[model samples]
Target: MQDAVYGVVSNYYQNKVKGNHEVGLIAVVHTFGSDLKWNPHIHALFTEGEIDKNNKWFKKISHIPYKYLRKSWQKLLLDIIKKNFTDIRTKRLINKLYKTHNEGFYVNAERDIINIKQASKYIGRYLARPAIAEYRITN
Candidate 1:
């Protein structure tokens, strides 16, 4: 699935893309849901500019096809898992995966990252903070 995410981004960035320069972004993998449940998802942080053929930075992408990105990621993950697991026991697991795949997957892209000011502040508070915050305390 990791490779799938990377491939989806890389393919779009490398091919079928124009105008913007080739840019690199960071992908973060989170396997838990918002309510602390078991839901696997990925958060992709993409740069606005692309690294051009000449290695220059271009402006960010204005319009992104989020649905296409989601489908591409889904297809990649399923393809890899099917290839790696050919055993019977794993077959059942694969079946379950397929069933869940019907529900579809999610891919979010942040296009308006003009500067790193807000991100830097977030990091400072995130890293300096503890696992549980005061808000989690109950009466």
Candidate 2:
């Protein structure tokens, strides 16, 4: 799952984001949700834009559309799973999921950091945190 997420994201940025330019990304994998359940997801911190072959970085003023991202993510995930698993039942299940979700998989670009400091802080917070904090647990 982690590999799939990284692959799809990189592909999206490389191909769709800004033509054929390269994009930098830092992916963090979270295997558990706030409820301490197995909810695998990727927290990827990426450059605001892409870097050209001339070694110049270009900052994008606009964000990628969520709809397009979601669909692309879904397709990539399914393709990865299909390549990895050859079981007919699993393949059928994946196909069913693809068919059931018209909007594709969820790919959210939650928040954007305005500067390098903010980006560093955001990364630090997530990296330093645990799967579920003790403060969030209540009876």
What lDDT would candidate 1 get against the real structure? 0.65
List per-prediction Cα lDDT, in the order shown.
0.65, 0.76
**What TM-score goes with each of the models?**
0.65, 0.80
Residue-level lDDT tens digits of model 2 in 76-112: 8888878889899989989898889879888768767
Find the candidate with the highest TM-score and give its number.
2
- The Cα error of candidate 2 at residue 120, in Å, is 1.3
Best by lDDT: 2
- List all candidate RMSDs to the true structure: 4.1, 3.0
Q: Which portions of model 1 miss their true places by more than 4 Å?
A: 18-22, 52-54, 88-104, 109-111, 121-139
Instruction: Show the colliding residue pairs in model 2.
Output: none
TM-score of 1: 0.65
Q: Report the C-alpha lDDT of model 1 over 1-139, residue by residue, as the tens digit.
A: 5567778776776665666455575555666654656767765555645776778776545555877676777778867877998888877876777688764456655555556896665445533444355787797
CA lDDT of 128 in candidate 1? Answer: 47
The per-residue C-alpha lDDT of model 1 at residue 134 equals 73
lDDT score, candidate 2, position 136: 80
